[model samples]
Target: MGDTGESQIKSGQGYPVLKPVGDSAICIEFGDEINDRVNDLVYSAADALNARSPSWLRELVPTYRSLLVHYDALAADYDEVRSDLLGLAASDSAAETSSSGGARQVFELPTVYGGEFGPDLDAVASHAGLDSEDVVRIHSSIAYRVYMIGFAPGFPYLGGMDQSIATPRLATPRTRVPAGSVGIAESQTGVYPAASPGGWQLIGQTPVQLFDAQAQPPSVLQPGHFVKFVPVDESEFQRIQAEVANGQYRVAHSEFAS
Candidate 1:
């Protein structure tokens, strides 16, 4: 669809700022804070934009509250592209605060908490005035929303963490955090996805490969997905790891309309 197409989506709350990024890109800021409602709008806008992308539209990157769109400066004029995007931002369907185009999948991820895998678990618990088991119980109880997939390949920036067990990041960044490590920083908790240097407080580890370069889409999770942690023992962790390596393990997920 071109910029002249009728807007089918309803308008959302707040005004979107269309800011230019350097020479070849634009960043559409939806809001400031990290929230589900705002992200839904971003997701919808991205879905709608990509669906009816102009020839100048190069790449669309959706984040917590903005959509970074890169255009071909050589093939298209920036002002024309800007006007087209402005038209999209003004569209009712794009303005609608919904992720209609994105498919949301609920994942039940198996994780092993404490001991060597979760070195900072006890320390974090002690700081929170609670035991390690209480920390695990509380952490695993909530179904976290995947706000965005960034940092490492499939590393999720998850929201909906329990306020009770909230903890800050490590003062000193670790040289290397192993892949599959689950960590919490302030009000957020997320998996490591891959081994990398990180500062988030480590709490657990998962055997599931969050990102597989050889896989069709690579990343296992997406922005609209909800992740549920299923605590598993060390033995089960080992078994799952082996199964995954042998390509016999299936990651359990369910599809439901949001």
Candidate 2:
């Protein structure tokens, strides 16, 4: 079914649409924008689908506004899978997962703002009409939400930056941004999962390994997780970095009743 529709429930405010991506996949769209209201439904539906998984279902990839479902082409039929998804979208079970789909994990990412790590901190501060220190205060004040992980592996796409300090992305992207680099692009801020090319204005750097190949989850952050940037002294940053590199540090994180 390549049709778009909205849920007829007040608690669930998703303007969801179901469409076929190919012969073996279906994408469930929940609004066409990136907002928490839409994210709730996306994750909730993921939980609902995972809870009662079809034998032929393969993987679920949740994005800003949609969930991509991949299935075994040999074992599954598109029409039947689409029908099952339609039934889910029209039911309250999919809507109810907004709160209980998964416990919202909170992570305290220790960052070293400014200096050699964050070369563009001063520029961002100047752009925002604030001093570098004040900029750090504003950036670290709030607990940002992990909207969706994309761009690079373990690279978290976070939201909820203070509008006052919002700065545009750099005119030309850096050829290589270090892993654990924390940057602000307009109203959103995120950590660089690896040393990759990016245009986001760099504000700080963290020692935490956002992605570890040998780690259980590989990616430290996941969608719906809450993150707070904890500013640390240069000495502390060095210490933590050493600890991390030596495999002696555990990234400080907790789970809340989200």
Task: Evaluate model 1: give its lDDT.
Answer: 0.84
Tens-place lDDT per residue, model 1, 96-203, is: 644555556889899999999999999889889999999999999977888788866888889888888889899999999999999989988999988899998999
lDDT of 2 by residue, 1-258 (tens): 011334224224645678889888999887776667677778888888898888888999998778999988788688888888888877845356546556777899999999888999999999989999999999999888888898778988888788999899999999999988999898889999889899999989999988988988888888888899999999999999899989998878887775
**What lDDT score goes with residue 109 in model 2?**
94
Q: Model 2, residue 147: what's the lDDT?
A: 80
Superposed model 2: Cα runs more than 4 Å off: 1-14, 94-103
Per-candidate RMSD vs. true structure? 5.8, 4.4
Please give the distance, in angstroms, between residue 148's alpha carbon in candidate 1 and its true position after superposition.
1.2
Cα TM-score of candidate 2: 0.90
Model 1 residue pairs with clashes = 9-92, 9-93, 10-92
